[model samples]
Target: MGAGTGPDGSSRSDEEWERFLRESMAGAADAPKEPSARARDVAKRLRMDPARGAEGWRSYTPARPKRRTGWYVAGLLALLTLLVVALAPGRTVDLFAGDDRDSAPLAGETARPTQAPPAEEAQRPTAQEPFRGSPAARWASGAAGITVPKARAVGWMSTAEVERALARSRDFLVASSLDRGVLRGERPEKAIALINPHQRDVQDLLKTAFRTPGEKSDPLLLFSRFRPSQARLVGSVVKTRGRLTYQEGERGALQVTADVTFVYPVTRADAGGGDEIVRTIIRRELVMSWDDPDKVITKPGTFSIVSYKYTMTNGGCGAPTGYFTPPFGADRRADETDREIDPYDRSGPVGGGGSGGDECARATRS
Candidate 1:
């Protein structure tokens, strides 16, 4: 018979096989105009040795033996053509051609949180919800976050006296750090009044700082304040968080310490019809002692400040104003110190020396 016909007369000559393949391929819409080198070799090998080539593909043949060879070859050619289209370079076909829904997250899986792009996340604050992208968003507002510890008798103080001391400490924190009036460049009278009147030097220093604020006399040392003309408070709420603790000290005094962080949202005075909000974070740690009334002549309800330290984040450094000069827009300056500090960190020792040099360092966050 012709060239290489099967024993059952099912195979066709090379010319007839080529003609049949061309007719069959005409129906494949995605078939390449020309077959690949590998495809041509496969076709040549199959035509030269039909029985060996077709042996593995017999089960896929639904036609009778007389027509099985053509049908099998045609099916394989179509499959290979489809694979070529898929693997071709610079060619792509979307499986979900017309679907409009986002396919980023699979079914039953939570959508990933949208991350703020670079130069957008930490560099600025949101306007509508000032704390939305910050950890302080979940923090309690104002005095609520300054929680007083359970009072217990320490040294010569009774439980009632200890409770009063703790309550007074919390009040001072509110007055100096969170009070709306105090934040607006107003004097922190209540906070300063809580201090012992016997500390003439301390009182004098505070008076000088507020009266004539300078590099050496910073009012920010004792209270959080901002110039009213420079900043407009975004909202009435101020986010705060921290802890209170007490212990016995030398001379039978109750040493009460408070470590607190406050977050304020404000807009520039000239931010007319604009939505630019800046968050100023201040972390203050104060150590105050109440002497035993029975043993020493101490004020009835006043506490003597032993030491005070603070970390100001997002506040304009190098400015010697009575109020905090939080950087806004072009007013942002490069950090004066290389040490990176996180304002939220409270595990370290409180009321200690800062990262050196003007107490200014880069904040890891707002």
Candidate 2:
């Protein structure tokens, strides 16, 4: 950044504070060694008393100068001044003279972080006030090329801070996504443990999963019309991972998310009353929001997973809808309405088309 003027602050309105920050940031890259000092000088020049005029910092000399020092003392003092000037970088007195969290008072007192009125407290906008930063709009295509609106950190968000937030976001996502093994084993407890205990959603999912654990039934799943046989189907399933990314949210929250592909080979009885081999694929985007995060994500990340799945219905083939697409994966074969497939046909993105898949299927059934 280079030195530049900001929004007209000559009027010194509350809005001026933001302008000052804009100016400060404009020259931030080439900032002087003494940034605090530079800030003070800028503030002083802008009028530590923006609301006041000449009465603010008028200077008054004593009635008469006292012959306090002799020439010998004067010479030493001058020499000392020269040495200090040569040795030190530009130095200025504290402008704010107040505690941390940046802000300068416009009333000639010391600068300080401004407190918000009761009405504005909910957002908890930062002390920067005028410089709470700007909004950044971004969008990403999730599981089915469906664009999800998201945000990017802008303004005061240092590159380091953004990266730090994103990394933690990713940590939460990868750790929180559903694990096929856990699901297949009917270890709902294990799946629930992956989520952050702080989230209400985790508790809700847990209550539902364990509502009647010993009975080999899940009323919630049954209520939602999810098949009990789906559990058995997952026992022999395969899943693939896709892209991972992060997005900023309101009040500086960051969200990390991933796209995963789940595949299940099924032996559903066809409407024709004949046995047919079918494969079902679901693409799910798992998201976890990190409103607060550790500076470093050294521990396994945890957050409730929010999921979205996209599978198109098009083919006349009555084949189950599939989700995985090319790049991270390929879409399952789509043209087959009611066509019978070989029990070991592994030609699709998933299922037992290859020899290894055939063997796995045989072993799974056995």
Clashing pairs in 1: none
Worst 10 residues of 2 by lDDT: 133-142
- Model 2 lDDT vs. the true structure? 0.35
> After superposition, which runs of candidate 1 have C-alpha atoms over 4 Å from their true positions?
1-124, 333-337, 350-357
lDDT of each: 0.72, 0.35
**Tens-place lDDT digits, model 1, residues 143-226:** 777767788988988999999988988889988887889988888898888988878778788879987876656778778888
**Top of the candidates by lDDT:** 1
Question: How close is each model in CA RMSD to the real structure?
Answer: 22.3, 36.6
Q: How many steric overlaps does candidate 1 have?
A: 0
